[model samples]
Target: MTKQQLFDDIEADEDWLTGLSTDIWENPEVALQEHDAAEALGDALREEGFSVEFGVAGIDTAFVARYGDEGPVVGTMGEFDALPGMSQAATAEPEPIEEGGPGHGCGHNLFGVGSLAGAIAVKRAIERGDVEGSVVYLGTPAEEVGAGKVYMIQDGAFDGLDAVVSWHPGWTNAPNKGSCLAVDTFSVRFEGESAHAAAAPEAGRSALDGVQLLGNGIEFMREHVADPVRIHYVVTDGGQAANVVPAEASMEVMVRAPDRAAVEAVSDRVRDAAEGAALMSGTEVDVTKTSGMYGVLPNHTLGDTILANMEAADFPLSEEQEAFAADLKETLGSPSYADVPADRRDEAAEAAMFTEPLDAPDEGTTGSYSTDSGDVSWTVPLGRFRAATWPAGTPAHSWQAVAAGKDLGTAGMLFAGKVVAGSLYDLLTENELLEEATAEFEERKGDREYESPLPADADPYELTDR
Candidate 1:
């Protein structure tokens, strides 16, 4: 089949894709609790004749679906976890479907289904004898709060892959060559003697005092670090009462930097500060590393492939779709163009929904957020891009994003599906493309081997409530 035929196939399956995305959007699940979401996608993959495996990496919601064998393997990731307390109806103004309920504020409802559409299309291409390769769809769960993919990588789920492709819902359409921050998430606890505050206070060693000192040390550390470094924390356990000296206190900390080394360096100093705080307050301290992800290893060669397919598959939205996006844009405040190029800022600011693909960012352009996909890129050649699933100025994890996710979001999703299909077609049919991408991957990875930051006995179930 020709690439155009693959595009046509995705268009023909639009009704099914829409229904699948809508169902997941209607019933939102959070983090590792996405049982219903995983089952739905797994059933769909089975119906399409792909062998499905559930509970990948010991995470109940994670799964893998595959088609074909004995050839090049290309994979795409689909995340389906929702944010907590972000429920909203498909309206311009704020209207939650259920008050303080979980919601698809990140448009992951569209994310998983879109990637499935692409993978299935590639499967069809493989059957038609146009491509001689396998199509793998990774059903990634708990991207919002839990790094399910990280554990999946640790379990060797992504091994033996030629390359991987990914897409996300966002305000602009672009083949992202930019990298985001690498982050280390951890928690610290301080233990000390408890005594009455008003009586025998000198006999007490305050755990609260250790937490305060650690916070102060972090504040002072801010000045010594680079501008991109971010250190933030919340006191999960402070004390029982002001009258009693706390026996124990805890703080969850997150340190983010441009890359893994930078994050490790900052984290080491933070741990040292905690130790010093505990010593000063006569308390014992314990540090636990919860999760960490590497920065995306940007591969321009793979990015070029995505850009080519994106530009070639020129599907613009209908007037009705544009009007729908325009209405949503009206409800939200003006969007930021700080990440957009200076010359294109005006154009980006004016679009109701940006369909035209932007140029890739320059080297050293790092975004402020992090993703579990970053860890996957370290293992294989990965291509990442964004499709406009929300209105121009709409931010993620907001009511406006949830509102747009129903209809306008689906349009962008289908666009992404076509891009993925076409990109995979090229990777499967063109040997040099994958070779160049692999070369770039190796060069960028250098000699560093991927290592999981979680403790050997760390359980992913612990993240379900967070």
Candidate 2:
């Protein structure tokens, strides 16, 4: 079948896909705890005639589904975890369905379902003898806090893939040729002697003092580091009471940079600061590296192919959907477009939903956010794009984003599914596109080998739960 026919087959399953997206939206689960979402997606994949494997990489919520036996293997990832404390109902105003609970502020409810639609559509084409290749859908969990894909990659779960394709929900329709910040996470704890403040203050070496000192050292170090570096922390534990000098305290710190080498460099300095803090406060410090992710390695060849499909396809929104988007835009008055180019800022602010696609940015530009998908990009020739799933100027991890995720986000999800399915069809039917992408991948990764930064004993559940 033609690419358009493959897209049509995806549209035919729109009802099922949309229903699944709604189910995930209504019951949002946080990182590494997505039992319902995993079960639903696994059942659907089985019904679609794909072989389902659960508990991939020893993570209970992770899984992989496969179809076709031979030829080139292409895969995509679906993240089902939601952000904590983002519980908002589907309305223009802020109203949480469950106060202080989990919600799909990042539009992952649509993300997993959308990617599944693409995989299922490709499976149909393969089953019909229209294509001779394999399609794999990875049910990736705990993207918000745990970096589930990193652990899966460490276990060789992503091996044997020719190329990987995926998308994220965003406020614009564009292919992301830009890179993302590589990040390293750490948890630092201090141990000291506790003593009554008024009775014998000299007997205590305050652990709380070490926590505060570490924060100060990090703030000072920020100015000395490069402009792209980010170091932030939160004090998770201080003490039991104000009168007692704290015996134990802990904080979680994250360091980010433009690439892996920079992250490693800055991370070393941060660890030294932790040790110095303990020395100054007379406390013993224990630092643990919880997780780390590589920056995305963009493949321009695949990006251009997805952009071509996005341009050739149609994304029509109904009057009701447009009105809803307008209401949400009104709520976020004068949204900021500082990230966009100065010349395009006005054009970007005009639309409540961007229907037209933007070309990928120049290579070497880095985005501010981090994701486990970055690790996957380094492992395989990966292509990523963003669809306008939320209202224009709506920031992710906010109540407004959760509000628009039910209906507005579904439209963007279907649009992304079409783009992905069509792109995969091209990759399987035309050999030159994959060849060019592979060549680009090899050239970009010259003399470098991918290595997981996460420690061997690091546990996703223990790291995120604490």
Candidate 3:
């Protein structure tokens, strides 16, 4: 079938995909706890005749669904987890459906459904004998907090995949071979003697003092670290009352650097700071590494291929959709992008769906944030693109993002589905594209092998109830 026909297949499944996205957006579950979202996507794939594997990689919310007999296995990724404490109603005004609850602040509600739409369209082509090879849909979870894909890789869930394609929600449709930082998440807890503040303040060792020292050390260490090496932490526990000397306190810290080695170096320094703080406060500190993900190794060949498909399958926003975006833009007021030109701020405020020019691939330029998908890119020659899901200047992990993901985001989501399915069609139909992408992957990866950063006995749901 023609590429347009393949894109049409994705459009054909728009209603079903919309329903899926809406259901996920409304119910929004936090990372690694997306039971309903997982089941919904899995059941839809099963109904489409894909062989389903439930609870893959020992992750209860993770799954793998497949279609077609044999050839090169092309994998498509789907993420369904939401963020914690980001509840917001889908309206122009800023308000939560339920305040302080989970919500799709990152637009992952559309992410999961849109990706499945791509996979389903590809499966249809495979079934019609128009496309050769297999299509596998990977249901990845906990991308916001824990790197679930890292565990899945350790469990050998991605073995035998020829290549993979994925999409993310973004404010613009810029597709390039962009890289992101390597990140590590760890929890630090301190224990000390407790006492009544008024009775005998000197008799008690304060764990809160340890936490304060740790924070101070971390702040000082940040100045010595290289640029773009970010360190963030939150004091999860402290003294319950002013009259009490706390016996226990805990902090969760995340560190990010341009590469894995850099991340390791900075993390080591942070750990030393924690230890020094513990020493000074007369407290014992326990540090546990929760998860870490590698920097993205962008494949130029794969990126170009996806960009071509995106350009070919240009899905413009309808007038009504644009109006929806405009109304949302009114509520958004001033727009903000990390690197937008000052002159473009006003233009970016209006919600619109248009493809940005393909940027020249820069190896040195990496994103400020990190994602679990970075691990998947390291494991395989993976190519990903961002669809314009929110109004211009609307950042991810915000009320605006959650509101946009319902209606305005659906258009971008469908367009993304088409771009993904169209790209898969090209990859499945043309063997040279895969070879080129694989060759690029080899050249880019060099001698670097993917190593999971989780401890040997690490549990996927250690931070949350499974």
Q: Please, what are the lDDT tens digits per residue for candidate 3 over residues 420-441? A: 8887888898999999999998
lDDT for model 1, please. Answer: 0.88
Candidate 2 RMSD computed on C-alpha atoms after optimal superposition onto the true structure: 1.4
Give the per-residue lDDT of model 2 (tens digit) for 1-466: 6788767877788788989999999999988889999999999999999999988878899999999888699988898889889999999999999989999999998999989989989999999999999999999998888578998998877998899899999887888898989999998999999999889999999999999999999999988999999998999999999999999999999999987999999999989999999999999999988879988999999999989988976675677887899889889977886545677778778877766788874355888889988999889999999888888778999888998888878888988988888888888989999999989998988888998888776777765745
Q: Which tens-of-lDDT digit does each residue in 1-466 have in candidate 1?
A: 6799988999999999989999999999999888898899999999989999998889988999999986699999999999999999998888999999989999999999989999999998888888899999999998876467899998888998899999999887778897988998877899999999999899899999999999999999999999999999989899989999998998888999987999999999999999999999999999887778888889899889998888877564778878888898888776677656788878877888877887675445888899988999998999999888888878898899998888778888999999999998899999999999999999998999888766657788867533
- Residue pairs clashing, model 2: none
Clashes of each: 0, 0, 0
lDDT of 3: 0.84
Off by over 4 Å in 2: 338-343, 362-364
Error of 3 at 429 (Å): 1.5
Count of backbone collisions in candidate 2: 0
Rank ordering of all candidates by TM-score, starting from the highest: 2, 1, 3
Using all chains and alpha carbons, the TM-scores for the candidates as numbered come to 0.95, 0.97, 0.95
The residue pairs in collision within model 1 are none
Query: Which segments of candidate 3 are over 4 A away from where they belong?
Result: 337-364
User: Which candidate achieves the best TM-score against the true structure?
Assistant: 2
Model 3: how far residue 416 lies from native, Å: 0.8
